[model samples]
Target: MNENFQAILLNVLPLLAIIVIAYFAMIRPQQKRNQKQNALINNLQKGDRVITVGGIHGTVKSTGAQTITLMVGRNQELTFDKLAIRDKRPS
Candidate 1:
């Protein structure tokens, strides 16, 4: 009985340690990045220049609850989902 219990504990301990290390190494950082992206999407404002994940570059013209309008070119306005924004650019 004692030997069986010790063997089980030894096997389980490494699995538990791997789970903890994986969480900190992969899961936690990904979650923080997602939160930061969500905050940026939610706080968008007009006149901000941004690039999309699709590589579109434009200046914000207006914002809606789920969508945003951008001025891409001369009289060229495009609409995209808020999540489409990848990063803001410095003017």
Candidate 2:
């Protein structure tokens, strides 16, 4: 029983180390990116040029309570959820 428990602990230790490494290498950066994206979306206003999650690029035409209107090109308009905006205007 003692040997079995020791072997299991050895195997679990490496897995736990891998999980920690993965979290720092992959998960942490992704979370930071998500937070930044959320901040950008929350601060959106009219006249801001934005890129959507679906890859559409447009200028914010109007803002509603839960939706936003985007003008993709000349005379082309679209509406999407506020959360779907991926980025704001370039400097």
Candidate 3:
């Protein structure tokens, strides 16, 4: 009976270690990036240059609860979701 329990534990140990390693290597960094993105979206303001995930670049014209108005060109403005923004552009 004891030998059977030991065999089961031996089989489970490696699986548990793999799960832990996967969380640290993959899941944790993704979670951190999500948090940073959320913070950036929340802190968005007018006139901030930003790039979208689709590679569109624009200056922020206005901000709303879930959307942003971007001035993409002369006399051209477009609205996009806050989550669509990838990162701010360097000045």
A best-first ranking of the candidates according to their lDDT comes to 3, 1, 2
Assess candidate 3 and give its TM-score to the true structure: 0.91
Give the winner by lDDT.
3
Task: Give candidate 2's error at residue 57 in angstroms.
Answer: 2.3
Each candidate: RMSD = 1.2, 2.8, 1.2
lDDT of 1 at 65: 91
Candidate 3 whole-model C-alpha lDDT, 0 to 1: 0.96
lDDT of 2 by residue, 1-91 (tens): 9999999999999999999999999999999998998788778888999999899999999988789999998899999999898888683
Tell me the lDDT of model 3 at 32.
100
Q: What does the lDDT read for residue 87 in candidate 1? A: 94
Q: Tell me which of candidates 2 and 3 scores higher on TM-score.
A: 3
Residue 80 of model 3: what lDDT? 98
Full-model lDDT for every candidate = 0.95, 0.91, 0.96
TM-score of each: 0.91, 0.72, 0.91
